[model samples]
Target: KVDQSVVLAGVKMKNPVVVASGTFGFGREYGQFYNLNELGGICCKGLTLHRREGNPSPRIAETPMGILNSVGLQNPGVDAFIAEELPELRTHDLAIIANISGNTPEEYGIMCEKLSAAGVDMIEVNISCPNVKAGGLAYGTKPELAAEVTRMAKAHSTVPVMVKLSPNVTDITEIARAVADAGADALSLINTLRGMRIDVNTHRPILKMNTGGLSGPAVLPVAVRMVWEVANAVDLPILGMGGVAKGADAAQLMLAGASAVAVGTACFADPYAPVKVRDELAALAEMQGISKVSDFTGAVKPW
Candidate 1:
């Protein structure tokens, strides 16, 4: 077997395959399908300072090879997560990366402070969730806002902090480097592309929110490119995402410089997406004579 163990920001994951936030639903919906412990770790659903009921109905609308959502960071609040979800999650024997979001830098710090004291392995600071306006675009679309939020989270977070980025920015790599320089231990990208679907008959957006984050196979290529760009911009490790749905897809990201990857929309296509990706990566590593997946990170041949 290849040396697949790659640590991102101090937390050791058996491999790079992880369940992306929002898609895996805090590992609850997938429990009936597979052993949650079998996976590397889960970037749980976005957690806000307070519990959110989520956006209106029709939050998810399927497309040709992608999905759109405006779910709005719904969660049981941090305390509930600690009291109920975290306790059960702890029993599962896997890294628990709490993904937190906030409307302001102060709120983000407070949330990170709460999770840090909980001893979570890592905190994925969600700075870009385009489905909502207040907290979503405020940090993601601006380099300064991104860095401010990232620095604030890192200041209060004892655990390593990961900044989740959006793809809507004009220059993604610039923002990525800014966040990294702001004290982010690592970064994960590219969050869903800013997209919308329209119901021609009704002349309105298909999603109840009218606009949503687009994720799936359609966005994989862009994600791969962003991974390479971000890798070239910063020395810290990176976790890439977008529309990875196969072993080769994961391999491609690795080759492009992803230290690890998080599976989001792809999970909607297959409950065992991460497992299959892991197996696929294992096979690819053996075939390519890669001793460790990290060896392939940023190995993209020049064009």
Candidate 2:
């Protein structure tokens, strides 16, 4: 029998399939479709220090191979999540990764402390949010800013900390190395590529935010490339994501160097996407005569 279990940065998962943040929404909605314990982990919706109303209407739009969203991080504050959501999530057998976004390093530190004390298995820091004190530049775009956030989160959190890297940057490895040096235990990459669409008839942008992050099969190649680059550059374990819809796609990322993979946009089309990917991945492992799924990580040949 193939061992589907994977150990990512000291956290053991039953499998390598995890649902990405902002798409899984605490796993309550998708729980109706299948058993939440079937997958490896769940990165909960992005949380801030306070509740956010999010952007105006028409924040989501359909693109050719994916979707663009500027949901503006609409979520209940961290306090509410700890009180109302974490308890229910604890009942599941999988690892619970809390994804947090903040406008400042101090804010990230505070949330990390709160979430870690609340008993999350790990913390996924979302540095894609604009640093309000830095003239609105994304923390993930600059190595110093990214390191600052990582350091602060590391200082405050008791559990493992994973920094999510943005694909908008010119060199993702620089940010990855910076975070690794700053004490990040793991990394998740290719948060979302910046993209936009316009209505030819109305002469207006489709999303209310004018532009938003693009996610879906459209970004798979870029995600794989970045994951491969960062994995080669840094020694930290990676939780790779972007446009993964099938077991083959997940295997591609694993072979590229990701210790684990996350299913995103595809979940919108099919709530069973994560479980399906997990089962198919196990089948593929068995067919390959591989006794363990974890052996797929960084197994790609560069020729």
Q: What do the candidate models score in CA lDDT, each in turn?
A: 0.86, 0.91
Checking candidate 2 for backbone clashes, the offending pairs are none
Residues 171-255 of candidate 2: C-alpha lDDT, one tens digit per residue: 8898999999999999998788888999999999998778888899999999999999999999999999999999999999999
lDDT string for model 1 (94-122, tens) is 77899988889999999999998986889
lDDT (Cα) of model 2: 0.91
Best by lDDT: 2
Cα deviation of 9 in candidate 1 (Å)? 1.3
Lowest lDDT block of 10, candidate 2: 128-137
Q: Backbone collision count in every prediction?
A: 1, 0
